[model samples]
Target: MGMMDTLDEWHSIYIKAGIALPGALLSARFRDEGSDEQKMGLLLATALACLLACAAAQNNNPTENLALRGRATQSSTYYNYVFGYLASAINAIDGNMDSNFYHGSCSFTNNDMSPWWRVDLLKSHKISQIVVTNRGDCCGNLIDGAQILVGDSLENNGNNNPSCSEINYLPNGGTQTFECNGMAGRYVNIIIPGKETYLTLCEVQVFGVPVSKKPPCS
Candidate 1:
């Protein structure tokens, strides 16, 4: 019921999860000095502040997935289902690469010629890499010949964007990561050239730092 009690509860959970409590979070010295309400409040606040700072550090880590925040649009939806296998699934940022139908819109497309899927970062970025996932279930071959394209252009529906990587054929329920070497772009697209096909994608992730005059991720 007290601040220390709460901290101890979280500490136990973290230990069980294989995380060690930081020294600052222990704060046994501060506790020994006083039981003052204000002091305990301040300690709790400081721990929270430190936790938030740790989170920010993790956000800046290159390994963090950056696609969850972008906006996605596809050439066609299986139907116009708002949450249906629309273009949005590619950037749902779920990191689910399974082919299970219960995976619920892991990826699918409207039957169309040259179907395309794209994500708008809404700001220019120095893209580092793009990761593509194939459906695990039947017909996972739908992603064959997919091109990873990046640029600021809307010309030809961004199909004219420069290619970062071309997917030859991703194995069923497989994932491929392509390094773009810091290509600058506000748009990232995936397309299978010269084909009337189903562009099924379990997920697509883009990692990058926003293009800015100041420090991009700071």
Candidate 2:
């Protein structure tokens, strides 16, 4: 079965068992009339539930103990939550290294011939690696060129300003992966300059440990 199917099965098992998700509940409460603060809080809660639902399914011992119940879990499911014509992925990898990472998949269109995909983590992270997978599958155009930006911020703003200090140029697309040598920053930007392909991202893989490269904690 697909990763999404696995997530759905897990959601059914752990979500409706009277476990009160404050974030999800609150989001639903004021979904329409809530302020930006409310919406953000709701989104964080939803992200948490998503992570937990994924964790419960991956773990075979959800009923083991309370410690197991409160722990956070990660998933490789590619949910298209971005505001573009492409889908994005949030994946976790296992290894001995500690770092921060982000991955995005972009789809091409006739209007935007030069497709560029970008996002900022908005917080500090020791990003050490990045990967741009080509899931063309013989349907969309292959991505042949790519670049990564790492710095204090992108475009002098905390929103999307990460300077493109490192680049990985691939003129022909099969599969491409880029690894940086331990750079610390608050934003990560990916730009793809190539043909516009339809539904190009199948999956994106981001690998990092939480100890040194901490995810945004509030």
Candidate 3:
């Protein structure tokens, strides 16, 4: 489905769950004439509203690291001459927290503008928190300014999804937790916006509950 369609689904879910969401306002901004900047602002506001609703739901539900059960991919893979494709995207979700890059337990992307990595949870979920582990060997600062986005759309490689939070700074080899406040989405994305740099993630753990039990991506 298209981005707007995906957003409509989110709006319906929130409305059905009895959460107050400005769905009409959101639709108007998208469907009516508006500047790109204004639309972008509205989009972020709508995403935040979804997140707040999800956060309320999280109060009564238990969550786990859903990323372990999901499929992972990245913008590009980093190939090591000696280790081959040791920096593959799947490493971050392998349930291992090894921070050393040489240990073959981290996902690394080729140095590129707006590098990103994503995980598909197989079904929509009300995400509560996302934990990211940075590489300890070196270059942890490169992850600074990275964004945590959650949504069902694959548009712009999921980078255009609503953002849960931004990493100002994460200490080397440090594992940081980002609260999504219950943003509902089937996909979670990590992207460094507006700069050319490597994206390395030692581990990415997502916690949440399924929004529905239905089969996805059919």
Candidate 4:
């Protein structure tokens, strides 16, 4: 018999004993050929497994950074770094921070009127939080007043997205994480408004799961 048929038979048995899930959830396909007691034991095991699976999934939060798979860019490049520092900084290798700005181990944007940097995750996600690393060298303070934005829109270089945090200060070589609280977005942006300044980043790490609209029952 098919798996679904067996599941349905077990469902029926549980229902008759007043201990089963609702009948509407059962889809007939599998058939059970084992003895009734064996069937009950198997069903009980399956139910326990399902419950354990759900608990495990809940515990498997996004501990590892999810931005390593994404692409990075800034509003404007400094043209001094041929190694694509802005593009490689999302998951850049460690650097001394003082001398590695041109090697793609960090990102540097030009002194534009509103310097910005962004990451394209390629798909929407329920963003939980973002960790941003600042350059350890002399000018890390340039990122002050930067706004962290998260949303699906690309307008204004994603600056139009809802703000998750406004960075006031970051010590040299400091790392700060802003909790987004499950904000939905595909783009993550950082910008300093109303003035020209450099936006250098040592690393950007995003944590979250893929966004879905489908029903959980499916």
Q: Pick the lDDT winner.
A: 3
**lDDT score of model 2?**
0.39
lDDT of 1 by residue, 1-218 (tens): 66567667666655533456667567554444565875666566556654654454334424646667777777876644564534344533566655564457565677789988888888888888898877777777888888999999989889998999899888888888898988889999899889999887778888887777232123
After aligning candidate 3 to the native by TM-score, how far in Å is the CA of 104 from where it should be?
0.2
lDDT of each: 0.72, 0.39, 0.85, 0.71
Q: Which scores greater on lDDT, model 1 or model 2?
A: 1
If scored against the real structure, what TM-score would every candidate get?
Answer: 0.65, 0.37, 0.70, 0.70
Instruction: Tell me which residue pairs clash in candidate 2.
Output: 108-197, 144-170, 153-161, 154-161, 154-162, 155-161
Could you tell me how far off, in angstroms, the CA of residue 134 lies in candidate 1 after the best superposition? 0.4
- Mind giving the per-residue lDDT tens digits that candidate 4 earns over 5-122? 6566555544433344534335322355656765566567657545544444444446656678777778776655454334334433232233335445777777788888888888
lDDT by residue for model 2 (51-156), tens? 6655544332222111111111111122444633223222211111112112333333233443444333434545445554454334324343444555565452
Question: What TM-score would you give candidate 3 relative to the actual structure?
Answer: 0.70
Name the TM-score of candidate 1.
0.65
Clashes of each: 1, 6, 0, 7
RMSD of each: 8.1, 18.8, 16.0, 8.1
